[model samples]
Target: MTGGGAAGLVGLVLVSHSAAVAGSVAELARDLAGAGRLAPVEPAGGTRDGGLGTSAELIAAAAGRANRGAGVAILADLGSAVLTVRALLAEEDALPPLARLVDAPLLEGAVAATLAASTGADLDAVTAAAEEARHYRTS
Candidate 1:
């Protein structure tokens, strides 16, 4: 529910060890991109017990929610979050079709990927946008 209800736009899944952190990041990215300027974004963070850790089930569910028929781009925080995503990717039929794990800064990368997806870019383009954010200069 982050976009203008635009159909076919690529979606985003934000993964983090802390549920609060993931949710807040998604909110911030949505606000930064502005309403109707992004596709569906889902946050899958922490464990079912509200503990600080990664959950594969949560990640899969988020990816499913984020999907809009176009594709899904996943951004994970460092450490086991990334490892969880990688493990999910390795399994057959683990993730939704066209869903991919993006290696980039959690905050900046999500914003970039969300902006790119808002333009109806494909999965590859959105992933590329997030990956490209790794080189963004903060100076």
Candidate 2:
């Protein structure tokens, strides 16, 4: 989806209250992932009206696009964003079975997940990588 041979790689979705934040984070994660092939990374932030809020519909749509058959990993900025993603997943049973909601630091988790996905990691691995990012400390 993202890299030329990334069709089988797991996808990632960054959720935030601000569209700009999501886009910026996605870019940073992509850069951190380096040249290896990576699955699609979609940003689902803000409401359709461009306000600061999360939308279940937008998240669901982004998940659909990111999940290029493999699976999707979601990283959220706040409680509301996480709640929105959870509601969408619960309501939409058609979403890919591999799709998973990860509780991790937004930027760190995105970077870790992107890197893992670029390496063609499976959904569980990618999610685990993201969750592990929470313990990453920069000294």
Candidate 3:
């Protein structure tokens, strides 16, 4: 685990309806950010039964695991996934204060968040980066 401070790298959690989607997104984000730069990028997708659905328990667990004592930023692929993450946060009292859900496009947001976190960016900065990715255009 890494040290916790203003300069500590923030962790990332990717939530999707499909486990494969979450895992693939994490891998892409890590590749885009360069290897060994990002902290724990855990994927919390699918339900306990391996079906296509989001699980609040899984999200909460992933958040806990992803936090390296610094903080965590969560990005979701769908509204339900976001809702699940939010519900988990609201229901879990032990969740870290720095952990937050970033309302941004999932793939772009994860990529941006991962890159920012890789640079030792603080939680707020990483969340901001993820949100900023929402405005990214490729025209």
Candidate 4:
């Protein structure tokens, strides 16, 4: 989680193809947290141009850095990023037990999940909601 109290319920992770996107993800998550939602924002991978995309090794390392050091809801940018995330999940001896995959609208999903998390939504619930989200408009 990111916050100190109930806010730390669900941790948010942003995996993008651009560093700016990652930063934006973190920022938006933070905003949601500030609004009394979820935990703090945790972002990994994604360089200034997000060259890392979704390399398993990179996602592993990044996932390893999330708050609470446990399961996280990863929000990706596009289909390619999703593929990379899938690849990471299928890796040999992945992060295991701690981290899991959460598919939501890359940007909107991240935002909603982070905000919902602020309200103490479980990782699974948030992931399900995010995945069900349709045609989310960007901020």
Candidate 5:
């Protein structure tokens, strides 16, 4: 686990309706970041029954695993997934101390967040990088 401090590397949690999607994005982001020794990057996707939906349990568990005492940035795919995270945030002590739900495109945001975290960026900077990825032109 990375040390907790102003310069500590933030952790990332990727949430999606489909388990495959979240897992794939996490893997891709890790590969893109090129930081083999980076902090935790977890994927929270699908329901406990293996159906397509958001799982609060999974999200909370993933956040716990990802949090390296530095903080955690969460990016969700679609509306319901975002709402699930929001509900979790509304509950006291549902997630890690600094867990935040970032509003950004899922794939791009995960990659951007991972890249920033890999550089030992703080939680705020990691979330900012993910949010800023929304403005990036793909053309």
Candidate 6:
């Protein structure tokens, strides 16, 4: 709703426990963008924030705005990001609709989500890609 023009496609966010993860994703997105890959990626982590999830909320807001009227998808790291997002959505009702949860190749999912989103990929497509690439251990 607020930043789609700059992002160019689906508003994508890299959610992680460590700020570095998010930062790296953003850097990667920028690099990809420079390579004419132009994807809208935002990093939500410790490096960009000291507040408890303020960064996440910030990312969500930007994503929501960027999605325009379309909903935004959030690709998170580990299981923590999902919880954090749920908590955020519970606390803030204004958050955009989360198309799906990405359970896959962490970094790969982030990069994929960004790239796919940048190209106007739907939530299902990217989330499916993330899930398809996911390799979490399950007992």
RMSD of each: 3.0, 2.8, 3.0, 4.1, 2.8, 5.0
Q: How do the predictions measure up, each by TM-score?
A: 0.91, 0.91, 0.88, 0.74, 0.92, 0.68
Model 2 TM-score, all chains together: 0.91
- Model 4 Cα lDDT, one tens digit per residue, 11-89: 6668777767777778866775576434645666564344755556666666665545435677777787777777877
Name the regions of candidate 3 deviating beyond 4 angstroms: 1-7
Best-performing candidate as measured by TM-score: 5
Best-first order by lDDT: 5, 1, 2, 3, 4, 6
lDDT of 2 by residue, 27-137 (tens): 999987876575688999999999999988778888888987778999999999988878777865745667788999999999999988888888888899999988878
The lDDT values for all models are 0.88, 0.85, 0.83, 0.65, 0.89, 0.59
What would you estimate as the lDDT of candidate 2? Answer: 0.85
Better of 2 and 3 by lDDT: 2
**Which candidate tops lDDT?**
5
Assess the local accuracy of residue 9 in candidate 3 as a C-alpha lDDT between 0 and 100.
70
Better of 3 and 4 by TM-score: 3
What total of clashing residue pairs does each candidate reach?
0, 0, 0, 7, 0, 7
lDDT of 2 at 124: 86
lDDT of 1 by residue, 15-106 (tens): 99999999999998888778764688899989989999999999999998888878899999978999999999999988988888888899
Between candidates 2 and 6, name the one with more favorable TM-score: 2
Error of 3 at 98 (Å): 1.6
Candidate 6, 1-115: lDDT as tens digits: 1234434355566677767666787787566546553555666664244643335555565566546334466667666667876676675455666534456565767666666
